[model samples]
Target: PVNRLDFGTSGLILFAKSAEIQAKLSKEIQEHRIERIYYAVVRGVPAAASGVISLPIANIDGNRRINEGGREAETFYRVIKAWQGYSLLEISLKTGRTHQIRIHLSYIGHPILGDLKYGVKSDFINRPALHAGKLDFQKSEFKIPELAAALPEDMAGLLEALQA
Candidate 1:
């Protein structure tokens, strides 16, 4: 069931016990039947309470970048909470692309706290400050499984810091 997570993202990762199941789930993902939700601690509060990021993404050399020539990528996000100059965001994906969330958030002027690639430098955390909070797979035949994960210690600590 293990699907891919960003290099810096931490949380529940789905893993298939067997290749057959993996293929089935992969097909479902391609068909847009799977949902991936993430939580992030980002820098700067969003001007809007909630919104969608619709953009195309492509790679520039070895790095992923938002480009008109790239594939269409869509992400929806809401500000769950906000602090002095930071925010807690609940984010979901409509289309998956490399660094989609990170790049999109950065593009919108709210790069993740620890995501130096697309965000400003920070000492608040050591990583991108993103977590795979939940996942849902639409099924009709048999019980596939339940997918959800709690925030890891590092992320939780960051939240506490923001709260104070």
Candidate 2:
């Protein structure tokens, strides 16, 4: 696979027709030529409408944590909508470290809804209220059009409930 999504996170996974193509696509990802966009419902609203979360993450004892000496990771997020106790966010990744989104959002005190490991469990959804909404390859040499995936039923239902 060209990229991966965390176990409970729903998203797009790129695959190659051959090993050679896989290597090339992997290189593109490593060079930050591909853009990944996500939609997430968080527990609370952020203080800012949009901002970047530049923090390093390290896997300690099988759990990801924010550590000063860890590998550099960056996540960008903008509040798309806010409700009484929840906010919808449009998120992008500058670096894709394991569990980067979950950790960063939790660190900022607005963990994704239903992300039990990073945040409190939710009654709205069974898994993290996150979805890989779009994969943009405009910057890459490959002439493929952008790819997008709609939110799964569970996430869509959660959003509907939140909106009401």
Candidate 3:
């Protein structure tokens, strides 16, 4: 996959028509020219309105965790909205490591809702309440059309209930 989201994550997954494009895009991603934003409903309200998580991640027993041996992964997140016990976050990643967002959020005691692999399970939904909200490649050489995906119904509904 040229770009990927976690298995239970729903939204845009970029695909390159050929390996050459894939290579170019990979380099662009590495240079931090690609813009990817995500949305997730988490277990608790963050104390601050926004903050950056600069945690290195290492895969241990098939799970990603914060470790010194891992590469630097940075995730910027802001509380979009909040209700008792939960908060919606708009997140952007500076490094694309497997489960980077999930790991960072979970480490902060705010695991994504229904993300059983990380922690906390919500019968409110079966899968992790995460969505790849947007993609921006405006600065890249490629003319790939920009993508902006809406939140899935299940997640949207969950937000509604929380708001209520």
Candidate 4:
């Protein structure tokens, strides 16, 4: 696969037919040519409606956390909606490290809702409320048009309840 989603996260994934294609796609990803967009329902509204989270993440005992010596990770987030105590975010990544979104959101004090590893679990959803909503390959050599997936039922239901 050219890219993978975190275990419980849902969204578009890219797969290559051959090793050569995989290498080519991997290069595009490494060069930040592919656009990845995610939607997450987080626990609380951030003080700022939009901002960037630039932090380094390291894997320790299989868990991802912010560490000064870790690889550089950058996450950009914009608050799409805020209701009750929760906020919906549209997030993009500059660097795709393992668990980058989860760790960055948690570090910023607004962990993704139901993300037990990084934040408290919630009744609204069993797994982290994150979905890979869009992927744009326009900037790459592949010439594939942008692809998008609607939020899965679980996430859409969670949002409906929140909006109620």
What is the C-alpha lDDT profile of model 4 across 1-164, one tens digit per residue? Answer: 88899989998998899999999999888887888999999988999999999999998888779999889999999999998889999999899998899999999999998888997687879999999999889889998999899999999999998888
How many residue pairs of model 2 clash at the backbone?
0
Candidate 2, residue 144: Cα displacement in angstroms equals 0.6
| Model 1 weakest lDDT span, ten residues long | 137-146
Give RMSD (Å) of candidate 3 vs. truth: 1.4
Superposed by TM-score, candidate 3 places the C-alpha of residue 16 at a distance from the truth, in angstroms, of: 1.7
My TM-score estimates for the predictions, one after another, are: 0.91, 0.97, 0.93, 0.95
Report the C-alpha lDDT of model 1 over 98-160, residue by residue, as the tens digit: 889999999998999888789766655889999998877655232556578998898899888
What is the alpha-carbon lDDT for the whole of candidate 1? 0.85
Q: Which segments of candidate 4 are over 4 A away from where they belong?
A: none
What lDDT, from 0 to 1, does candidate 3 have? 0.89
RMSD of 2: 0.9
Off by over 4 Å in 1: 138-142
TM-score of 3: 0.93
